[model samples]
Target: MPATAIDIGTYAVKVISADPGKQPNIIRTVETLNPHGIAMPIDDLQIEQVGELVNNIVFDNKIPHADIRLSLPESIVSSKVISIPPLTDAELASAINWQAEQHIPIPKEDLSLQYKVLYRPEKSKQEQMRVLLIGTRKSLVDRFINMFIAMGIEPTLLETHVLSLLRSLDIGADEPPTMVLNIGATNMDVVVIFKGEIQFVFTHSGAGALLTKTLQQTLGLDLQQAEQYKRTYGLDPNQFEGRVRNALIPVINTLTNEIQKAQRYFASQFPQNTLSRIVITGGTSQLPGLVEYLSESLGTEILFSAPFASATGEIPQENQQTYSVCLGLLMRELA
Candidate 1:
């Protein structure tokens, strides 16, 4: 049976069903907005609402209660890269568990941990392997798992949004260093990838919602009007005599400043590897002139995420960006 991949975000819940293959057939896609707007996962009411949304989508689409893959929001997952001496699988597991105590701030008993070996030296004297460690509170994971269980959906895999984003891009092992800027409704995730491995992931509060709020406050317009203006004239100095652009400049600058800092830090760490290009994804990435603005400001080539290039589908263009995480979760299952 084909698996269902679900991406639960602050503003919306996206679900996609696809068969396993080189080019999975996107059987169905469903999205539903959260009526309560943005709420932290700690809120039981928000969780209940999300569960209802998922239940409605599954029922409306007549989707079977099959194995489901979920994307954990970046805001709740703590990720880090740790270096340790090469060891046997058994030894590595023990060592990682011990190391987790030091790296993860939460008590080890309260957090569920997972790690992936990212890089290992072929013929080096260092004798160490770089591993990516991810830790999340058990309560958080259990809440989602229990919710799905109650709905008769089996939760098989749960991964960070950054990792799922990486899989969606189909990046090659030999590809150069690239940065992925995922601008969503409530938050922005900045991910740095090199040689098909994630080097860094950062999340910020500056995103589409912030831009809309800025516009609403500055122009004294309603939420809907502000959103329309942002999408229609975003960052284009020539539009609305630059009023919209001027209003959004402060928020844009805050996001860009963080991006620039991340780039500098990455450059410092990897002096030999220059960022080859940047790929922008998520809902906010489609704002008018965003590509041009980021490309010029970061001084790097900019591209948009195109997961559908390999998959055969008839999804709408406007929904493509929002489905990236969902598609990526399916890709992970296929792999």
Candidate 2:
């Protein structure tokens, strides 16, 4: 079977279709500006706009529509991890709503809740199962469904960008604990993966837009020039005589501080392990000197994401980071 995935971001929307395998053949890829400003938890009024956008993208590129998976931004969803005594499949199906009520702030009636059994203690009677609970407004889900219908497309799955980001990486079991950072236009997610399994996610606000604004303010450059300088110089000390790096440091410190706290807490929880490397992705993360700066700040190895390395296809160099989530979604069926 082939897989087609769509990733909608604040500034753009990307679609990809590929054959199913470890290194599947990439059929086609399309990316377009989201000129209509459609949001994640879209309103009823915006459904038509989203539909129009999807209609144009799919039609513009001869994308094979199979297992159409869509990724929703994490900001519109509420998630929590809870522990409960292990239960049978039937028991879990019946108990999930109740568990959701205790962990999620949304009203049960208005929420569309989903859960995944993250861990189960096989031999220990005293240990409880850990479940990942994800919740979002029912209205939001309905709107996305309606939008797809209007475009004559039946979506096979609705998911978050975090899972897709994880899917894009090729984490090794023997590798040291690693952090995956996704810094997008409006938000950021720092996920810690230990021994090829996701341990937790640390989300933060103020990402690329914030950094660009900081450059604009301190450098007295227009928004366009500021963004250009941000990409060209980033936090690299040697570039631009270190001015751009200096201006951006204070702003980046806020995120580095939060990530460092998460690192400390994870260490406390798993005393034997350390977060050694960070896999940086997303358009903002591709900044000229970000990987080096983050590695220095956290005292960890940093690697930029190369999502298509294992996939048999050629993609634009700049689009590599931007398309990570969609590539991961495609992997759900392909790999």
Instruction: Tell me, by lDDT, which candidate is best.
Output: 1
Model 1 CA deviation exceeding 4 Å by range: 38-40, 123-127
Model 2's TM-score against the true structure: 0.91
| Per-prediction TM-score | 0.94, 0.91
Q: How many clashes does each candidate structure show, in the order listed?
A: 0, 0
Candidate 2 residue-wise lDDT, 110-163, digit = tens: 999888887777865779877888898888888887788777778888788888
Best by TM-score: 1
| Candidate 2 ranges with C-alpha deviation above 4 Å | 36-38
lDDT of each: 0.82, 0.81
Q: lDDT per residue, candidate 1, 209-255, as tens digits?
A: 89999999999999889999999999999999999999998898898
**For candidate 1, which ten residues in a row score worst on lDDT?**
34-43
